[model samples]
Target: SCLTDTRMMIKLRAANEPLFTGRRNAAKAAWRAILKELGLQGKISTYQMAKKWDNLKRRYKDLKYPPVGMESVADGASSWPWFQLMNEAMEGRLASSAPLLTPVTQDDDHAPDRTPKHRPRPAPPPPPPSDYGPEPFGGGDAAEPSDGPLGDLERQWDALERDRAALDRDRAALDRDRAAVDRDRAALDRDRAALQAERLWLERERAALERDRALVEQDQVALGRDREVLLKMRSFPVSFSVSIYRPVSEREPFAGCRPGGKPEPARNKAEFFIFLNFILEAEY
Candidate 1:
């Protein structure tokens, strides 16, 4: 059951954390997606999934940091069924005092005994009658070394050594996690810079478009003034001719026409102006 639970929790954490977009609605959407992916939308609600994860975290914290009066987990690894799995899942997210867990195999538990076997020896023969007055060291010889207080001291030393090793492993893991976080920060900074560049490019394009629009407006205004001038010119008769004849007595003289004897007819205003100019020249 613990294995199954841990596996489920791992999947949920993976799905939710990556899909979340920093919004409440997005988080709910991520939960829904996770439920759909796991085919548990109908059986389990998002609230339940959240509660289960919280419970798992709480349990992990309890094991990692036992109560004040209780002894710490000096064996390096916890005895909790799914602690190792949870540790892997929450590796960079949670702060844990526990060390890396190594599962014990059957071979490790059933290794061959290495303690030396006690061999029997023949009884020592009685010492020869001592002529010297009561040998001082006859039966007062000290007993062979027995593993009492010394053995306990050795066992404590071994436990302390294990605790130190576990602490070293924990420190190394923390260092690696820190490195990963720093990498993520650098990547985020690069992305921010890219987004800022894109924004500036959009602004420049918008400004260029504004300038083009202003030029187009000016052209439209010029065309409107030209249209008004052409409308005024259209008011004149489509066909007209002008011929002016003056005598030499006048200050201006007419050319190609002597006192208006005969003048060429003009078709349009342009030809009429030319005929007028010729008469003025003749008068001069």
Candidate 2:
């Protein structure tokens, strides 16, 4: 996304335009048309388009590839000479058509603005042979002169180049850090997904356990009724197993309790009920 957008902005700025509002509006209209082509007309609005463009412009405006031109950046508090150059270039172009910068009357005027005087350029030196190439190191005019404004400008440019190199290194380090952060975020996301799956499994197991508990409660109810009927019947066999009709010693009817731990003989239905509940706890 960044590559494609930077390329597009490079093309638009090749003319050295500051990309004012009218141009941005035109670009926004073009975007709407593109959305229409993509069958996304309903997802378009002027404010949204303008906002996207504004954000892109603010972010990419600082993206100077080699950081050669425009030495100063105006951070909203003060004016810079580079901004004056841009304004001069713009006004120079607009001088022919637009009448916005008109002369003010004496009554309306506060003070005359001091425009910087531009110096005329010197004539170019004769070109060398095409095959000769650039001047060699420490040879001819390739060396930095020790005086004059030109020398100062050269020193500034070299300093800016060094600054740009440092910025590039910082940006590369930030990219590596961002990649590591993304990897950690992806791993965290995987762990979160795994936790969600495990929680779901636990929920299913709890539901199965609840169904088993319901079945056990139902069995207890049925077993109580069966015991009541047996107690009411004098023909009840003393040798019967509590779980099933397996044979046991004629006296050991309490599902083979501990030796000599035979429950006292029940005298009534209430005692029989107590015995039945005690045996039921053993899953009899």
Candidate 3:
């Protein structure tokens, strides 16, 4: 089936969208979506879509601006099916310094009679936008291989993606380290609390020991006083006194004390006086 004017316009408009000029993958995806929307996915591959867009732009540029010697070349572009649609889509996109018409000099007018006028080939379209890189339109003219700005942008995008992946890995590692640090801090706090409790208990035990020591000191002092009193008592002399009653007759004093109250023998008087002197000396 032939593509209608409406379908050609749709293709031109879709190709000119910003999404079709982004990163390679995104641009290809956008082109696939455009093809799917046009119900041409099975018939037209993504590569075909890209090539079609490139060819359209090249044709539009050729028709819009004829080459140096082909001033009247664009005269037939109006009859082309997609020319108007491409012109509309590519409005203000193509930039050129070449004059649309070449000035005729009197010497060149006279020299033109020597040969038939030849139509020069149209030049390639202007470079794409700086932000966008060249799209890889496979099967395009080999002269217009996918290179230049598009290749540089693709490489830069790839580098940026690699850097982003590295940063993500670093961020994940940092999060894990932070979690471990928090756990370690919690453990240290628990240890500190336990040590504080143990210190308090030890202090209480020390206080109790101090009290016991004080009581022991007081008991020692009291014991020391009691010991001093006992020492003094021991150092003092102990004496016992006995009295001997001298009767009218000293020889008969013990005789009256006898159980029968009988008179003592005169020979026992000397021994009795000696016993009395021994008791007196012992008392002194």
Task: Provide the lowest-lDDT 10-residue window in model 1.
Answer: 102-111
Model 3 lDDT tens row, 110-190:
111223379768889966632222233233432332333444554454455346546756977999999999999999999
Q: What TM-score would every model get versus the actual structure?
A: 0.34, 0.33, 0.37
lDDT of each: 0.50, 0.42, 0.53
- CA deviation > 4 Å runs, candidate 2: 1-147, 234-284
> Which one wins by lDDT: 1 or 3?
3
- Return the lDDT, model 1, position 3: 49
Candidate 2 lDDT tens digits, 128-181: 732212222122322322224443453354454346546756988999999999
Query: Which candidate, 2 or 3, has the higher lDDT?
Result: 3
- Model 3: how far is 153 from its true place, Å? 0.8
**Poorly placed runs, candidate 3 (over 4 Å):** 1-148, 240-284
For 1-284, candidate 1 gives per-residue lDDT tens digits of 43454466455564345444343333344544554555454444444444455555556656666677654542333445556766666564422322222221111111123354886587798778422112221122112121333334434433543465477579889999999999999999999999999999999999999999999999998888777656654554443321223322442333454465443233233555775574454334
Model 2: ten consecutive residues of lowest lDDT: 102-111
Best of the candidates, TM-score: 3
| TM accuracy, model 2 | 0.33
lDDT of 2: 0.42
